[model samples]
Target: MKTDTRPILSALPEILKDRCGAFICCASYEERSRCISGAVKDLPFERVVIFAIADIFSGIEDRALEIKSNFSNKTNSEIVLTKTHEPLFTANVVAKSLRRIMDDGINDIFIDITTFTHELLLILLRQINRFKDRLAKVTCLYTSARSYSIGDPDDRKWLSKGCKEIRSVVGFPGLLVPGRPTCLIVLVGFEHERATRTIVEMDPELLLIGKGIPSVEHLTDESHKAPMEFFHNLVQTMVSSRGSVEPFEFSCREPYQTARTILELVTKKPDFNHIIAPLNTKISTVAVALAAMANQKIQVCYAEPETYNFNGYSEPGDKVSIFDLDWDREL
Candidate 1:
């Protein structure tokens, strides 16, 4: 069945006035930092919260200090440094931090999960939902990069050298109730070979693709027509006999739709156990996290890249758009 999809005006806009603060994930790429800084300048946010892995916080803070005056001294601003690759630990720490923010009476927030790890992103989304009532507004912001890493031949080889079936941070034993039939939903992105290996090993009874929409149209030779298109073609050939491939398109920037897509699938097929692997946009990763938060029965998994070629990943474009995505307003 065909699905309904809409693109937010592709034209980027300046920051809206209502936002009081921004919560952004720090990234290795300068573009991600530039996007957040540009928006904060226009909104002139009073509170700025930056989340970064401990290893990356130095670079993150250096970039923030360039645009935000007295960044470390601002009473309303703080930086959250987290351990790398430990999602559960990130969840426990971030949950408490966000709760404290709620208790402290910061009600309106703008969130940018552009560079967060999948596990960390998911946990943060749950906290947003957990404190939705106390929070007056929540705007999810993302600055789309001009291009993405296809990885160097050497980097690709290292990433695909071996595949393991280790349980993910959200999927360790006793994490969720068992005994239900499982369905795997993989969000297809640029890493084709690794995804192929994962699909074969997992051998999902049902396979669905959360098709990712690129923030920009130009793609390098290594790039697929769309991240999902590449997956669709690959899955069709690989899983033709195993199961039918389902594709759903979602904007890379408006991640709430990704959350809706996951929720819709779970609701439509409540009997099946859901495992979501987001190998695409951090925005979509946030969506996957949102869904997992709503239902603990759902599992969120991350493919551990042996080493990411941070220098090779596409930098963010000069443009950034800010929108008021008050999803709770409808409720």
Candidate 2:
């Protein structure tokens, strides 16, 4: 049998030769390493940037140093270590830093959010939006490495909502790509099929609507209605709450189309208070961008199976489950 490694190898050179930069934000050294390794193996870019959240780096400095040494021979890579203990790397700071990096002419940026808070990821996405036009291709990789406590179900749900908001914004042009498995796909309750018809008729927003677990999976088909229904229901829910809602549709299979849809949405709707997203590694970056675009306070709640407090806080010792929510609502 003939083997086909050509596609993989071909993509590598393009990714490597392309102007690429990456950011890895997490609370654990092991998580950071995994992100770094995954990035290196996937992209063939000549330049790579790795940023680590401070809390996870404190105890793993020695290990980090070792990892850095291992890659010392690679001339096109650089690592940025930030201390989460300090207030310096705030969302605005992260945004500015990313702008600087992109201004320096590095395209194809990647961010890994395996161990960071949903808030931090939002900050990064906001920064990416600042330079969407100037930057090349930006990709975010979300890995489910951290476990949330059982006591914070509300928190998890909030986080999931925040992630959806980020997707709304990042899915815009010159922003990050969506439909990747890492992107979050929040399933609002299934409603009547008329929900999809309403979305088609209104055509209020530029959205990538489809059916399937991952947006990417339904990208190839142009007739999927789940996304449209989701959007329609979301609009109805928002309007019912006295909030204005807009919709935009795009081809999730094509990066440019996805980006264009996002850009259009941003241009058309400037009064939306918040963008709700799911809490998954794949879609956190999108949440980040929405928070920035709205310039409003971003809030998240996780939806893990862990028990939550009456006030929606999670205890430290609870066992986190899947179904975590990633969302951002306007404050």
What are the models' TM-scores? 0.74, 0.43
Q: Assess candidate 1 and give its lDDT.
A: 0.58
Residue 271 in model 1: shift from native, Å?
A: 3.0
Q: When superposed on Cα atoms, how far off is each prediction in RMSD? A: 5.5, 12.7
**lDDT (10s digit) by residue, model 2, range 1-331:** 0011112212332434443454334434343344334434544444445555555335545544444444433565555555433433455456556665666677556554444444455555556665767655555443322322223332122211211112122222223223311112221222222223333333333332222233533222222234334444554554343222333333323222333344454445443322333222324224334433543322222221211122332212111111111222221
The count of backbone overlaps in candidate 1 is 0
Task: Mark the 10 consecutive residues where model 2 has the least summed lDDT.
Answer: 317-326
Candidate lDDT (C-alpha), each: 0.58, 0.37
Which digits, one per residue and each the tens of the lDDT, describe model 1 over residues 158-232? 212233343465432213446666677887665555566667766776777656654443221124344446454
lDDT of 2: 0.37
Q: How much is 159 displaced in model 1, in angstroms?
A: 10
The list of candidate 1 runs beyond 4 A from truth reads 1-14, 42-44, 55-75, 150-177, 213-228, 235-256, 294-296, 321-331
Over 4 Å off in model 2, which ranges? 1-27, 35-44, 72-76, 83-88, 92-96, 144-288, 291-331
